[model samples]
Target: MIWNENIECASRDSMSQLQTERLIRTVKRVYHDVPYYRKKMQEVGLVPEDIRTLDDLVKLPFTTKTDLRDNYPFGTFAVPMSEIVRIHASSGTTGRPTVVGYTRNDIAMWAENVTRSLCMAGVTKNDLVQVAYGYGLFTGGLGLHYGTENLGASVIPISGGNTQKQIQLLQDFGSTVICCTPSYVLHIAEVLEEMKIDASSLKLRVGIFGAEPWSENMRRDIEKKLKIKAIDIYGLSEVMGPGVSCECTHQAGMHINEDHFIPEIINPETLLPVEPGEVGELVFSTITKEGIPLLRYRTRDLTRLIYDKCECGRTLVRMEKCKGRSDDMLIIRGVNVFPSQIESVLLEMSETEPHYLIFVEREGNLDTVKVQVEVQEQFFSDEIKELQNLTKKIKYKLESTLGISVTVQLVEPKTIERSAGKAKRVIDNRKI
Candidate 1:
């Protein structure tokens, strides 16, 4: 099942040695080519020589999204513009989009990483893959696109949106493997239900989902509805897209592609490395990237690392599914809560649908959190007492889990808008 046995199953000592060598070369390249990196290194009173072994990585300055923005379009690029073959960017909702460039070699490496990920997810050359992630500036679509092609699989290249057409293509093309965001896949499943389409008639067997955090409950719901193996894939546009890590058929933690990208877990508050198997901020250092090699880039995702060999026989380190993001944490009435916690609670309830939204608003001197969730059609009834009981049950569970009182409103099915991309899970209107 491993795509590259030599690298994927390499011993810890050998992998560490390879990472150290690549890390040294990356440091040298960035220190000499990128003035911003050189200045950052000089500010820390260090040079490329300071990073000899993997242990020395702690001495290097950490890269952040702000650093990428300050550099703008091309300042972060290590190679010359002539050598750069491709460019991709983030949505830039907060500010300027974080731009990423890829040289020809970088593109090939990216494809290899994703290809390895696809193989780990049980995809093969014989399976027809449908890529529903948005293409172009967004890295998800094309990242999976080229990887599927590189794996020698037939690719539909359907991109995102057009739900009806997507369903038709899924049935007609006989796509055995689907790649897209988890939420989008759920939306597609909803559409199939609306059309009264039998999931048994479809050829889908495996689904590779990523680009957003999803709960384990949601994964089970997806698998049950679609009748496909729901696999969690992790990646960020800033760190070479969706190929950074993926789950094998084992369905344990996602395996990090340590050969190309070095994975690290550090306490976000202290900015120090956490003990192995402890939850902390996930960081990555792109060692083999040619165009935009990054050193110790903070991903802001919260997860733990498992260095033990996997049951699937791969020796690569695995990262537990992300709990939430450090910046995405919401403090309601002086109590910190994550949307995933609420999601976990809702998904556990059979009466409620997976789609829900959290609305945080300031009411006078107090902040109120209101959760609007969809109730299954079969559960919807005209009895006021029954509705009140359902609401109370949801509110009690959420308060017990989140440790904060919340207003639970049970709406009808399909009340909340579904997305073909990352779902908007939270809307905070408090002007803090």
Candidate 2:
């Protein structure tokens, strides 16, 4: 069912007016309060007064992850420390982390967005949601946690990992909904299989999966293995976490909460807006955020937006499932490849399991890619000739799809390591 019918189903004329109003206020505030933003605005030769309409948003300088990293600490926050009630930083693997602070109102807005997302996935106040996303500095766990509470649903804040305990609670609590990265949910499914327990035994009816780009084939696998509707949710730590947009039960596309944050798509290479329905980098401008209101924040995610009204009766614009990230695209030798492309090919084959990883390395001035794929137990046999043929078959499929030859190593089921978070899809060892 639809949540916040007034806003979600609002007409384009009305939504644009609301966005323009918030954008004007946010731009004015950031220009006046945040020095970094003020300087960026100066560099663009535009002032807050120039941003009178949503069309003027193009005048604002784009914010990048580098900008956040360079600032570190509390450099980009618009509000004073006295007003900042909570702080969340990115779990960066290198360099200083991108820090984000939130006011009480910001937290409430976040909760409202997440609650709306849960409702989009058909979650009711009576549903028990088991949030398996990790907690702490990561936004996934607490983001979902606060939203579930706001929705008045019973939430089991059982964080990630602990396979045994996760299954134990699922059986005992009979939670109707689960939330976590798509890959982690697959890992849980594997554990359930090892324990000789069937998914039908649980009460889980829906799963909200995000944090990593997954294939449509993989969604089918999740649905079959978990016996639940695998709904795709979209968000990032920089944008506002997993509740930014979510797929309704119709499963057409994720509906963006345009009232709180406005969405835009731009050509990554040219840094210009792409035509409607054309894939490009996704950008967000947080108009309602007070603690750290970002103007024209580039998210680097590559996806197209849909404007047609959905069968679910929501007029909120929809974003197609992410094709891949412009930043995440791996350029091996001359051809660019995405992990999801390989995943789609593997999942479509019955003999191969869903678990796999890609290793990119440089040797003697040449780039090499090796794919480690898990073969189903029935397909993993000692017959060298049969295994060789199977490997060749998979290699041909991948080569045809990716337009690049890759070394395919077929291993027994459960050989590839399973992760409790976003699956480590690629390991690039090139010293570029």
User: What does each candidate score in C-alpha RMSD?
Assistant: 12.2, 12.1
Error of 1 at 114 (Å): 0.5
Off by over 4 Å in 2: 329-432
lDDT agreement with native, every candidate: 0.87, 0.85
Model 2: residue 14 alpha-carbon error in angstroms = 0.8
Taking the candidates one at a time, how many backbone clashes does each contain? 0, 0
Estimate TM-scores for all models. Answer: 0.78, 0.78
lDDT of 1 at 287: 95
Weakest ten-residue segment in model 2 by summed lDDT: 89-98
| Tens-digit lDDT string for candidate 1 (344-397) | 777787744588899988664246899998878665778999988989998999
